[model samples]
Target: MMKIAVIGTGYVGLSTGVCLAEIGHHVTCIDIDINKINLLQLGNSPIYEPGMEQLLTKNIENGKLLFSTTHKEGLQGVEVIILAVGTPQGENGAADLTILQQAAKDIADYLHNNPIIVIKSTVPVGTNDSIKEMLEDHCKKEILIVSNPEFLRQGSAIYDTMNPDRIIIGSYKKEASEKIQKMYSPLNAPVLITSVRSAEMIKYASNAFLANKISYINFIANLCEQVGANVDEVSMGIGKDKRIGNAFLQAGIGYGGSCFPKDVKALLHTSLQFGLNASLLEETIAINDSQQELLVVKALQRFGSLNEKKVALLGLAFKPETDDMREAPSIKIAKQLTKMGAEVAAYDPAAIDNAKKILGDIISYTQSIKDAIKNADAIFIVTEWKEIKNIELSSVLKEAKLPIIFDGRNCLNKTKIMECDSIEYYSIGRPAIIKK
Candidate 1:
């Protein structure tokens, strides 16, 4: 088994650490946050990924997984080091690689042997080569630098890592590629070996393309509304074609979360740096940024005077099964409602704590889905959580002062919502469902 050390216990690093250990490799996940390390040492996950905590507990018990806050202490005798640090978006649209550069220096300073250093973060092209040079400057001995960008989704990280569609191994050195491939050899997934530059471009391009699909469908959905057409039906029709396929085609509020928004912008800036005009991505970002304000516009049209009106904001996080709200539409929707003098009560399964840090006492946070919608004048379903999707509209009407819903995610079924005569429902890509 490859003794691996994964740095930065954020969403990607933590998931990779646990999945690597589960595959029979002895792995240690290190982070700078002492509080997070304390929690992980006690078998609790700082970030919420499905099936991570239980798997982390099992791996710790079996002596395959370990946690630490110090890189110097964590790298002793580790044959391979994976840098899974954050590449946050800088002020000018490029990905800030400050953390990644520091991680490379730390690995070089503490290395006991000539171990392979893998870049698991989604970095810009040529970053791996720069890391190799940085390491050589710090260490007397030569070290191998490999680019192995991760494609794990936030919610289904474990499943995606264990059963990846394809594993990308980008290395300049053949020996370095072989060593990294052996680390994930147990999974038996198809591994693609390419140049380091290609691998870096692959990560940025893959995410940028997915972001394009979302914005394209949303633009189409808006056009469908204008033409009295249904986007859901249109999406289904186009999805049947072999070329289009059916992924990232769901028409709703624009893309958010950690990867799509930032990566697409990063790719755009990278292209610009090379004097290339990336118009499609530039428009994609513009559309997504405007999409966040869509629900507020609709709400204002439906109710001109929102002063003293109670609006229930459902789903705080950008998506379901995770508590990350980096670019969630709910952020804008809640602030807009409050700006218009409307009372906002919000509920999310996992992101409430994080939301509180950003939202503060401006809006009231509720305990249950029913509580968020109850006693409210209007409802805005921003997230597609399973709990919110399965809620009874009749029960909502009985509890709420008014039975009006604006489904941003289109979570509620239109046909079923139409069965009730007292409810006024509005969703994406379809005509508003109103009571006679």
Candidate 2:
């Protein structure tokens, strides 16, 4: 088994380190956060991901996984170093690589042998080269840098890592590429080796394209509503054509979480630096940003004004099975609804703690769906969690006073929802069922 060090303990690092260990690699995850390292020492995960903590606990018990608070501890005796530090968005929309740069310098100081440095974090193009140049001044040996961008989803990151769509290894040297290729050989997936720049661009391009599809479908859904057409049917009809496969075609409040929003903005920033006007990418972001307010517009039309209206928000996290609220539509909607003098009762099974940090003292937190919907005039469906989707409309109507339901994710069954005469159902790209 190859010895490796993953330098970061966020969603990307923890998941990567644990998965590599599960695949028979001896991995030591390094982070600057002592609290995070202590939590990992106790076989616990700081982030929410399906099947993540279990794998972490199992791998730790099997002596395959290790955690540390410094690179000096984790990098020693390791042959491969995967840089997975945070590249948070800056004020000007560019990816702030302060943490990544710090990690690279630290690795250079702590390296015991010449090793392959894999860029697993989502970064701007040419960041791999930048890291190499920075490392060269500090290290005496020839350092091999590989742009191995990870494409794991937030909720199912473990499953996605274990079963990746494609494994990309971007390296300048042939020896570096082959060595990195052999490292991931056990995955047995389709591996693509290319230049460093292409690999870095691939991550941004892929996220931008996925975000484009969501915006495209949402725009179509809005048109469908205006023209009395169904977007679900349209998506199904078009998806049958192999050229336009129906992934990310769900008509909703738009894409959010860590990847799409950050990557799109970072790419736009990069384009601006080169004097390239990326009009399509700019419009894609505009469409998504506007989707957050569409539900409020629908509510405004139905109620005239949201003055002291009790509103129930079914989901707080951006999506289901994840507690990540970064750029979540629910936060925007909650703030908007509250600004309009509406009382919002927000609830999410997993993200309540994280949501509490953002929506503190603004919206009331609810423990159950019944509590959230109790005496509510309007209910806004945000995330399509199984618990929220399985909520009975009739039961909800009993607790709600007026029972005007705004289905943001189209989570509920329309047929069953329509049968409830006491409830009013409104969803994106679908015909509204108004209770007369």
Candidate 3:
């Protein structure tokens, strides 16, 4: 089994390290945050992900996983160092590589055994070359850098890591590429080897394309709403075509998460940096920014004003099963509702604590879906958590004073809403069921 060191114990690093250990590799995960590392040492995951903590505990018990706050201990005798640090979006719409660069410097100082460096973080094209140059200069030796971008989704990260659709390994040396390929041999997935620049481009290109599909479907959903055509049917009809596959076709308020928004903007920034006009990418971001406020616009159009109205927000996370609130649509929706003089009681199965950090005391937090919808004039289904999606219409109708529901994610069952004639139901790309 390969001995691996993974820097930055965020969602990607922690999940990757845990999964690698699960596959029988001895992994040490390093983070700068002592508190985070302390918690992880005790077999507790700092972040929320399904099946992550269990694997973490199991691996710790089996002597496969390790956690540390310093690079010196973590990088010792490691065969591979996986860089999974954050590349947050900067004020100029470019990815800020400050953390990644810092990690590289730390690794350079502490690394032994000439371990191969694998970059699993999303970066702009040519970033791997820059990182390689930086590391070689610091170490005064030729260092192997592999562009191995991660494609794991947030909520399902554990599963995605273990069962990836494909693995892309980009490197300058065949030895480095083959070693990295053999490391993932346990996964038995298809591996594509290319140049460092091409592998870097693949990550941004993939995220941008998925973001484009979400925005495109959102545009269609808007058109469908105007013409009374069901977007669900339209998505299914087009998805049946093998070429068009239906992955991101679900019409919703928009796509929001750590990856899509940052990667799309980063790609647009890169395109413009090269003196290329990327109008489609620009529009993709624009559409998503607008779509996040659609439910508010709908509420405004229906009520004319939101003065002192009590609105229940069904979910606060960007999507389901994770507590990541970065660029979450709920942030925009909550701000808009509060600015319009509405009282919002928000609920999410997992993200309430993280949401409170971003949202503050502006909106109330509820423990249950029932608590969120109590005595509300309107309810907005934001994240579509299983609890929110399976919420009894009878409970909403009984608890809510007006029984008005706006489904931002289109998670509610329309047939059930139709059966309950007293509740008003509105969803993305679907006909509103309003009772007189």
Candidate 3 or 2, higher lDDT: 3
- Between candidates 1 and 2, the one scoring higher on lDDT is 2
List, residue by residue over 1-436, the lDDT tens digit for candidate 1.
9889999999889999999999999998888889999999899998988999999999999999999888877888899999999999999999999999888776777776787888999999999988888788778668788999999988899999999999999988899999888889999999999999999999999999999999999999899999999999999998999999988888898878999989999999989999997999999999998888888788788988889999999999989999998988888888888998999999999999989988888999999978988889899989999989998878887889899888998878777787887888888888888894
- Tens digits of per-residue lDDT, candidate 2, 157-212, equal 99998999999999999999998888888889899999999999999999999999
Q: What ranking emerges by lDDT with the best candidate at the front?
A: 3, 2, 1
The per-residue C-alpha lDDT of model 2 at residue 425 equals: 89
Among all candidates shown, the one with the greatest lDDT:
3
Tens digit of lDDT per residue, candidate 3, span 1-436?
Answer: 8999999999899999999999999999999999999999999988999998899899999999999887888888899999999999999999999999998888888655889999999999988999999988888899988999999899999999999999999999999999999999999999999999999999999999999999999999999999999999999998999999989999999988899999999999999999999999999999999999999999998899999999999888898989999999999999999999999998888898899889899999988888988999999999988877888999988899899999999988877888886877888888888885
Instruction: Give the winner by lDDT: 1 or 3.
Output: 3
lDDT against true structure, model 1: 0.90
Off by over 4 Å in 1: none
Superposition TM-score, candidate 2 onto the true structure:
0.99
Candidate 3 global CA lDDT score: 0.93
Assess the local accuracy of residue 334 in candidate 3 as a C-alpha lDDT between 0 and 100: 97
All models: lDDT? 0.90, 0.92, 0.93
